[model samples]
Target: MSATPPPYHQTAVRPDWRDLPDGLREAVGGRLGASVVAARTATAGFTGGFAAVLTTATGARVFVKAADLARQRHLADWYARELAVLARLPADLPVPRPHWALDAAGWYAVGLDAVDGRTPRLPWDPAELDAVLAGYAGVAAALADPPAGLTALGLPRLADLARSDILWWEEVAAGREPVPPLIPPARDRLPELVALESRLPGYAAAAPGLAHGDLRVDNVLLDPAGRAWFCDWNWLCHGPAWFDLAGLLITGYADGAGLDAVFAAHPAAVDAPPDALDVTLAALAGYYLTAAGPPATADPASGAGTVGPGAGPAGGNPAGTSALLGAHRRFSGEQALRWLAARQGWH
Candidate 1:
């Protein structure tokens, strides 16, 4: 990452307390054991899901997320999966605890103990980044030998998922997809990119364990005590610990931190392959760059032209998701690529 990095903030179009249906509101109140007095909608993340910190008449505050079961079944399923994952996490970890969940009035909602915290400020606060890294160190240590209960969930492996979903350089090299505009310098280097990303599956398989598959700054919360609490568990998977460390360091790299020293000093980097960081960056760059490509115009399912940003493709825009997701991906991809280029002197 350079002295300047792409913006990490996201402005979501979320529903307010008043927008919730009567039945849904009552259901949430019942779960909280009191009537609601005030609500503060969260401004982070790239989703349209109902996410807020609600204050009850009894002065109790809790975080709640709801999705319309009928209109956003996929989002509802994600919420359900996250609830289950949160329930199984170690009690002492900084991750939130899931208290309860309910289905009411065609909507599914879950409640969690709210933390008096805010997302980490960008430009990489040294103390805040230290807190996030320290917190993630503990998470990685615990997941290195994941509890049997979490393993019982039979979560997908990152190797398999990456091979299927993240390896887009191969597609670009074979002419199946267009080269992303952000990487015109990468046109002649697709083969090298492919080779770099190709090593990820093997490296991941060699030291397989639990990983916070989506370990980004937005997914972390810094408490008043300066502890980092990880959030958004729907993408949990089995992978190498260094994978999360690398992802976390992307922002650090963009913040102009001495990442080589920072990465080597981290506990998660122990026993990691010498080239692990490059592999992870290559895979991430390919994933984000390809995902951030121009929106599809044809509905692959119907073979007809479609409208909107995420219209027609295998991973096209789905309901209840954020529209700014593409912008986020583009920014992330550019950061990863720039960082990788700097490290490898590809510039």
Candidate 2:
């Protein structure tokens, strides 16, 4: 079987067993009532911190993750949000079950049911895609309305991204940010592009139910039973149910899966808002175009690396820069934008 690149790339640094703060580990132990026998480190996630499945004294397994808020405050905070989101998800949802969480002295960690599975590799497995779509269908069914505490928890709305997340293309077009030569053709049509994207918030705001705001390959795991479980609930939101499906379509497009072919078989994509695929693709294009082809202020990870510093509201790049990271974002963004344009008939 040929392997395509992973749907998302995680090249950020992660700490090993020796690197976690003493309090965080102790807190995990205290909550589980098990002595930490070994830390099986994980390297797939992008947050670039500590993530592992802990083996307890009694041979019990619990998934545990911790991040340094002081160094990467936003990512750490997002990890904290996962604890909150996990606590309230329905029992049947295909996600890790949350056991406990800890936030002491700025270091945060959470323990979850260790899932026995693997993130699916690319070239799109039919069985795996079918399983994941079924999982998404379940999520859509369960979250047709937001759960009781989810709204009160104050999760972000997709409309909130209009100014912040979707306007990137416009910003770079106007020369506010430096432009990179490797960009989408849509940038040249800024007014039209901006107007097209501006319409998304209304569509997004009118979304029927809660959405997994970030749904990509890296954030998913396929179990031995061929079931799919979505990870990383930090970007959870109240939005259109089909949003994740749209992202998947775009991902398919990027991976040479034949966008129409992916959509024809995906029931959720078939049932989503008529214009959602185009709009969501546009939104993705706008978001990625900003980082991929800009004056390098920060690195944006399309599926490989991330802006870490220059990509979001979190702040600027503190770690200086990495050419490899930038190249990944730029390339991923370029492809995503192009795909969006084709979907929109902008070409």
Candidate 3:
């Protein structure tokens, strides 16, 4: 395994929710009742802006997502689509009940039955980890057969997306501005990165299934009873199961041994193709390279401050980019590179 990279900053751009339009407040009050109190922003990072807790007069707490209207229409669209998908899911699925949603005004708000639980911290117990993974597997199984009349979520297929990501990295290596190093090795091994792109299609065709495109621990909530409620459906799409598994493992959940245990516990995921892992690493790399940057106060609509000014705030801070890239290297660097090398066919 390659040595892990150094720590980097994780600066996230947060939008002030007090800046939301008055119509949005009226819409929430009308739908959720007049006594809705808006809480501070709960999430900070990436597009779609941030989330605030809306407490109703009846004490019902809902989450309101205010997105960058211009740059992240996809997030607003995803929220609506996810609502539809959640509505079709089995009533028994361990997910938050979608009470209501408003898609207009560049805001996506959904009322969820609040689960009184904290985000599980790292170095989790084996039992707890098993429960979380099992919960994910259960959700995937329940939604195994998507409902009819449902259009495929417009997310790019994972393998194809991975190939595209590697090419982007190569472009960065070729001195493309604003495409700095998330993981420096990616720049050092441009040929291998290119190879990864070529070999992706074969793997993509071989294993196809429903996947939670982003399945990190942060997106899941584990209740006191040990059940995990997966949230953040912004990236759900059709892909291999291993893509999800690899995401879980690579994002600092399980190591090689831990991943083995997860697979052993859930035999249904046994046949998850290796390419799924490759895509997972590639996706992580691509996201860091593309989205991670200095805190951009730029409205996503204007696309200004999208990358921020300077080589990032101060000092040699890599911020979100380094943390993300370091995670990939620490958890799955060899696997990531092997996938890249296989694609490049440059031994």
Candidate 4:
């Protein structure tokens, strides 16, 4: 079984509550109507943004994430976009509710209902994975036909996003990006990979719907009752309903789960193309491989190889500047490629 890369679980070096600017702190406290009595910094995911659960003297708690508007403008923009997306999301959706937002003291911050839960344990806890899959079923059903209010945000089409920002096979085939050592067969299979990835846009447009866009284990919270709450709304987009399911199952594939069976059983797969999973895997593998970064021939302005929270096209990683993120990307990409290879009997 492919193990989750340790780096994926420890990418953040989050700032403590006290490390925040005094002005920003004061503003947050004012908005919450109480000074923070205790703060527990969250240390998950690949961003250096300030995220924590803050408790007031009255025991009121809120999960807050903040970014310095000047130094981390990309993160700030992402935060702003997330808040907007959350505000527009369906009320019954299993996402945290935004409590408030602040744009003061050169920082942008938002408070959300603190989830009394933790990130799902890796290595595929069967029960937890089941809960997550069930949760996603609801998400897919709800978003299959998004309301005008939600779609009004003008999310990018999955096909357009994949073509312009996500896919990377063409770059690799052209020798613009390095071939990852683990996927040596990719050198010979470049033509097939490119063809599979090239089909994503047309496939996506044929069955378009709103999608979670960035559904990873790190972005899910398993509550005490074992319900999954999806987070990170900045990547929301107009896409095939099955897209997020394919992305979310990558870890399952890594854990040696029967991902083919799982994918076929998912409600999101109802109308998906017979080869949709293959196409998506190829595209995502390409995304992660290049997202690991520093490909000399990649367009400097495209920022395709970089990591972190800069939105590209509509929104995505502007640069893969973090070593931790690079490691996670490499691990994810390799796993995806390996899984696809196995499915295609590519050895």
Score residue 155 of candidate 4 by CA lDDT: 78
* Model 2 C-alpha lDDT per residue in residues 1-347, reported as the tens digit of each score: 11123234444456886777787777778787889898877756545667888898999999887767687676667777888898898878889988877786578777888988887765467677778778888887888778888788888888886566655655656767655454445646666665666677888787768888877666788889888888988888877766677665444333555765666556555556666666676666667545544434433343333355336422344452333444444544555567667666675
| lDDT, candidate 1, 1-347, per-residue tens | 12343344444557898998999999899888899999998887666789999999999999999999887776788888888888998888998889999999899999988988887887678899899989998999988888888888888898888878877888888888877765545546778888999999988878857998888877888898999999989888889889888887774443567777778889999989999988998888888777765643443223222112222213665544555566556666777787778788775
TM-score per candidate, chains pooled: 0.91, 0.84, 0.69, 0.91
Clashing pairs in 4: 306-319, 306-320, 307-319, 307-320
The prediction achieving the highest lDDT against the true structure is 4
TM-score winner between 3 and 4, please give it. Answer: 4
CA lDDT, every model vs. true structure? 0.78, 0.67, 0.53, 0.79
lDDT of 3 by residue, 89-148 (tens): 567877766778765565666665565554555545677677777887877775456544
**C-alpha RMSD of candidate 1:** 4.5
Query: Clash totals for all models, in order?
Result: 2, 7, 5, 4
In candidate 2, residue 60 scores what lDDT? 92
Candidate 4: global Cα-lDDT? 0.79
lDDT string for model 4 (146-253, tens) is 878778877778888887888878877887766654566565898999999999999988875788888877889899999999999898888886889888877444
By lDDT, the candidates rank as 4, 1, 2, 3
The reply for model 3, stretches above 4 Å from the true place, is 1-18, 38-40, 68-72, 103-108, 149-156, 163-193, 253-265, 274-283, 286-347
In Å, residue 57's CA in model 4 sits off its true spot by 0.6
